[model samples]
Target: MRPPIDSGTVLITGACSRIGRELARQLARRARTLVLVAHQKEPLEELRDELLASNPTLGVAVEKCDLSHPDEVDALLDSLHRHLIQVDVLVNNAEQGEFGLYEQQRWPHIHQMLRANVSAPMLLTHRLLRRMVERGRGGILNIGSGGGRLYIPGMAVYAGTRHFLEGFTESLRLELVGTGVVVTRVEPGPVAVDAHAPPSWMSISAVRCAREALEGFERASPLVYPGLAYRWMMRLVSLMPRPLMRATGMMAAKKLRQGTALLEERGQRVLLAGGPEALSR
Candidate 1:
């Protein structure tokens, strides 16, 4: 069954950024109301203004919230409650990740990643799911990543969290099968959000990704791979044996380790030549 996108209020986290912004822009013409949640107020307001300019009748609310903090998420929900805005659709789109060796990552940064990528979505779902169930109509669109399916050495923690979402979304879909609350996960490959081209075979523009994701969610598809080329590639990869997948991943892991070694060597030379202060600089 298709989600009631054209009928109810949709709550979108990370509503100020690339995919989130595009989703809000597109959904403005569809959803009766849009609740835009982000870490900063200014960008969210800017987006809201832009949306209002195009669709003057659309109801838009901007909520500044850092999803990594539980208190902030709670406050955000409270604020929504006070406004008498019940969410009919939930888009768990906010995510943060550090691209480096797991050991080199700071504890605080790692914790924040976990909170944003995993804890925040889980908590939001828990708080809002009951209302959706009671209302007998709702939608959950999880913006996941291809990293959830593959083994990546450098992005250990980030990949792990995506895997959690992959599993969680799939199981949740099964549980809510008969219920009107439709759930779908969109696992996109690299998305080219900037002028600089990403070095990948499976990359699509953020606008296209958002459009495809929404289409899939509305159709109540279990999983969506955004790009056409990337979808085919992932379909092929899924058929590969586990050992073969691991072996292919090992190649990437080796290259990352080699790059780390070269960086260490350069750091050592700088330390010896110009002292600790120079190295820091």
Candidate 2:
């Protein structure tokens, strides 16, 4: 079933980030009310103001909540209930990824990734899906990564979390078959996040990614692989045998280790020390 985007009150988590912000911008012209949820209060407020500036008739509510914490998730839900705001659409886009060798990665970063990438989305879906089922109309969009299906070297934990997301979304879509709720998981390849770095031939702009995501959601596609070249590449990757993939991953891991050693020799931080942009690809 098509989601009621034309007039629905959409709740978008991680609304201040790239894909989330783009989704909000496109939905602003259609969705009745946008509840922007994110960790930073200033960014969410800024996004709300900018969205309203472009869409004067639109209603926007900025909520500050860190999805890495379960108690904060409950607080967010309570705030929604207290305000009597019924979320007709839920977009689970909040994510945290740390790129490093599995043994060298910090426990805190891994825990945060587990909570934000897996636990938070599951909690939000569980809380809001019941009302959607009862109302007989709603949509759930999960923004995941191609790494979920592919073997990535430095992002072991991040990739594992994404794999769980893909599995959970697929299973949930099956269960919601007759419930009149739409579920879509968008698996995007390398997305252009930094302007200073030269664009990769395989990477797509964030705008294109968001546009393709919505197209897939509206079509009720169970899974969406955005970007033409990337889509074809994933298709080819899917055809690869597990042993070959493992061998390929081994090569990549060796390169990553070499890069880390070379950079450390020059007294420089690791490649992904910058942030998720490295592993986000």
TM-score of each: 0.92, 0.93
Q: Which candidate is the best by lDDT?
A: 2
- Candidate 1 local Cα displacement, residue 207, angstroms: 1.5
State the weakest 10-residue window (summed lDDT) of model 1.
270-279
Report each candidate's C-alpha RMSD, comma-separated, in the order given. Answer: 5.7, 2.3
| Candidate 2 global lDDT | 0.88
User: Candidate 2 — which pairs collide?
Assistant: none
Clashing pairs in 1: none
lDDT of each: 0.86, 0.88
The residue-level lDDT of candidate 1 at 278 comes to 21
Residue-wise C-alpha lDDT for candidate 2, range 75-159, written one tens digit per residue = 9999999999999999998888877778777788788879999999999999999999998999999999888997888888888
Residue-by-residue lDDT tens digits, candidate 1, 1-281: 87779958999999987788888988999888999998999999999999999998899999999999999999999999999999999999988866666787778888988999999999999999999989889999999888889887778887899999999999999999888999999998877655234525667777888899999998899999998889998998889899998999899889977888788888832111111112123
